[model samples]
Target: MKDYYEGESAVFPLFLVTSSDGAAWSRAMAWLFPTLLLQALLIVSFLHLIWDWFQKQSFNKQMFVLVWMRTVLGGLAAISPSVGSLEGMVFMISEVTLSIHMYVLFEIFLQSIVQAGIFLWLAKRFLILQRK
Candidate 1:
């Protein structure tokens, strides 16, 4: 038989071996490592924030509310779309995750804001402000 890739006179190989997948794996690793690091850092940072809030006796409730909506709920939303096989849902979750991640990155700014409706500050020992 003739191979379509070559002229009709060319014969196809008895066994085909290709390096395309090797190239693809290399490309995948290029981004995969960095993505893993980023995801780990994001998880750590958000976990630290939640831990801080839990330990704190005083903070802006409104700030926490906004943060909760953006980080916690957004994280949940991101997770929800991923477990399903709906078309385009992963893309949508990715977009949402990207936006929420940005917000989470700037959470300290939210932390600095004044709570509008109600403020909670009932600490006695000491307050620790983590700076990134």
Candidate 2:
């Protein structure tokens, strides 16, 4: 079986972003068709998930939490461009994915946290009413 990276690499622009220097960003952008396509799919999926959750559809909270956590960790891992000996290509791949993930994860987690807080507040009110 192909590695996940390999599966994505053939079509994704990760190679272009990571392997090129200053003169290559434009050319790399041209080669980034797969990456852009996947990003579109991601946006659709995220919209569906949010819509489904809001509609009271059954969904796992843990999945959102896990994605959120991974995003945060990945963002941190991409922070330092100067610290590692990794190839420029690999670093670029990490940095871009991390940045995208961080943004998506934060948005999802913000909604989740707000929902949880409201639920807790209601539960506390219910308990106080029962004690009267």
Residue-level error in angstroms, candidate 2, position 25: 35
Which stretches of candidate 1 lie above 4 Å from their native place? 1-20, 53-76, 79-132
* Model 1 / residue 84 / CA error / Å: 3.0
Question: What ranges in model 2 sit over 4 Å off?
Answer: 1-96
**How displaced is residue 74 in candidate 2, in Å?**
16
Which 10 consecutive residues of model 2 have the lowest summed lDDT? Answer: 80-89
Clashing pairs in 2: 18-89
Error of 2 at 128 (Å): 1.0
RMSD of each: 16.6, 14.3
User: Model 2 over residues 3-52: C-alpha lDDT tens digits?
Assistant: 32244443234432433345576776776898857754664465457654
| TM-score list, all predictions | 0.30, 0.28
lDDT of 1 by residue, 1-132 (tens): 123113433221212222234775577668888996786567447656876655453445545654555444444344443312122234433423444434433553344343211223312122333331
List the global CA lDDT of all models: 0.42, 0.45
State each candidate's clash count. 1, 1
